[model samples]
Target chain A: MGTFLIVDDDESLHKVLVRVLKLEGHKVVGSVYNGSEAVEFIRNSKTKPDIILMDHRMPVMDGTTATREILALDSTQRILFISADETAESEALKAGAVGFLLKPIRSADLFRAVKSCLGEK
Target chain B: MDPMQIAWHLMEGTNDIITSINKDGTFSYVNRALMEKLHYSESEIDTLSIGTIFFPGEQKKIKAIVTKDTHEIISDVQTIMVTKEGEMLHVEGAFSPFFEGGKKVSTIALFRDISKQKKMEEDLERERNQTEFLIDIMTHDLANIHQEIISMLDFLILNEDLPNETVGIIKEGISEIERATRLISSVRKISIVSKALPDLQCMDISLALLRGAIQARLAFPEKTLKLVTDVEHGEYFVVADEYLVDIFYSLLHNSLKHSKKKDVTI
Candidate 1:
């Protein structure tokens, strides 16, 4: 089981992703609204999550810039971008995101991506 | 008949308006069609000019075209003109520089009234914008709502230790949510067809069928479905997108809905 930090503007999604991750035997370490909070969460936390579920569109900061910032702080940080916008897939990947999942993501697909990010078979 | 006379007769007989304006925007010549459409008589022609004929809002634009320096034809210049009654008339026409003794002196303009076409085009654009706006709400906002419901259902299915029948019912509810999501996706695809092409990739047809079967079974939990196919997963591939799964799901859902037998094999 892996640990995850959920970052998304949608509160409904945060609840769902956290519950789904917990149901699948993974720990949701933290949840934040935007990318800037996510950066702050990672910077202050003593124990970082194994994977970060990043969202693209947000009010204060976007996922791409946040991904770049967090990865700059720690290159080993794993980020999996989850967004409703399909166009953000390439941008997320280019910004040091390990994976990109479009929104309305099935729990199965989300698990697969998380497992892949964790380097699990 | 002389060709010049025939040409003049043709210009006079056509429904298209023809008028020549001097450098100072004064009417040099006005065809019968122009005079009749603009409600100007030969006696009143001296009082009319480019400024008097063009719609008030369109005067500067029309004047620029009429007084342009180009000898080349300015084609399909769409603008509004005002009739004697002050009614706006949509027109699209061409302007040609009229030269005398190798010096440009006036502009000869020919116009066809397109008020009906313009109204129809504007109505269509308004309707299209409204449709796209609704589709945006459905795809983004409504889609999130659907996702929330699906997630709730999924959570119940995994966490709740309910009876087998209750779990089946919950699964059916999730399937209904998926169906609604598919409808929203279909509307999104239709709206974006003119904007961008579909993203097609090499998809495993068998996998799509399997996924469809699983989701379809969720919709009919009371029924025992046995999908018997010779095709193996990853063996058969087709150029398709995620819509392929939607198609398969729709077909299987219809088949299951119409079937009378509780236990069906396909």
Candidate 2:
């Protein structure tokens, strides 16, 4: 199990993801609405999450930009992008995301990706 | 004035560039409009050949029109012309051979400038491309919203305490969301097809039919389907894209869904 931070514009998604991640025995460190808040959380929070679930399109800022900023803040932080836009995959990966998951992702796939980030089977 | 002079006067008054090419390829006559558009005077035109008036890039096509062995009328031939200052002008025209005593003596051609229309078409194409890019962005956002709804619904369905009826309702809503996603995908495909020609290749249509039937079977597991086709005996090859399978799938799926009986034949 690993600690996680959720960054997405959708509040309902945060609720479900928090519950789901808790059910899998992972710690929900924090949740932020956009890339700017995510970067702020990473900077000010006492506990660093093992993985950050990043979303691409948001009002204040976008995931790829945040990914670069967060990695610059803490090179050890692992970011995984979940987005509906497949076109952003290359940019996200190039900006230092661990993985890119297309939206409408099944819970099974989501769990697998999180587990893989922890070097688990 | 004679009838010939009257015809000459009529040709001279028009904005269209008109010219006659002799058997030896030299210009025998050029209307006033032709001389003005080409920046050539009456005396200068006598020294010019038919080939010199056409843009260098259009020389090959012009050669075909002028060197034909038989007397034929060529209409709506769009070509580029070069003025004396070496500027290119786009024009469309018809060319007809003038036969004297059953022998082709010269060719009379008429051309009208269409550069402005071509530029407008190019601008419209650019606007269309921009619209497509915007549509793609919208589609991505819509898909994200759909994904959020689906994830929430899936979480709700996981609750063991919920009644079977409520679970069934939630499941139905999820299915509807899936249908909406498919509709978006179809619209995007249609937009793409409208913009460019589809890449076509020879494909075995029988395989596509079989795949479609398999898809339909998976889609409607409750319905018993009997697909009868003569595709097995021969190779049914056609030039088409991957959507051919979707076409067959839609037809069979619709037929199966609408049929009242449990068993369907198609």
Query: What's the residue-level lDDT of A21 in candidate 2?
Result: 83
Look at candidate 1 and give me any clashing residue pairs: none
Q: Score the docking of each candidate (DockQ).
A: 0.32, 0.36
Model 1 TM-score (2 dp): 0.66
Off by over 4 Å in 1: A1-7, A22-52, A55-79, A83-97, A106-108, B1-15, B21-27, B30-74, B79-90, B96-106, B159-161, B194-249, B262-266
Can you tell me the CAPRI class of model 1? Answer: acceptable
Global CA lDDT computed for model 1 = 0.84
Model 2, span A1-121: residue lDDT tens: 8999999988878887887787789988999999999999999999999999999988799999999999999999999999876658999999999999977676778998988898831
lDDT for each of the candidates? Answer: 0.84, 0.84
lDDT of 1 by residue, B39-102 (tens): 8788998899878999888888877876777789999999998889898889999999988788
**Candidate 1 chain A worst ten-residue window by lDDT:** A81-90
Cα-based lDDT at residue B51, candidate 2: 72
lDDT tens per residue, model 2, B1-266: 99999997889999998888776778788889988988988778778875789887787787677667567799999999889999888899998988889888788889999879878988999998898888777777787788878878878898999999999888778766766665676677777888778889887889989887887665565579999988872487999997898788788878987999889988
Clash count, one per candidate: 0, 0
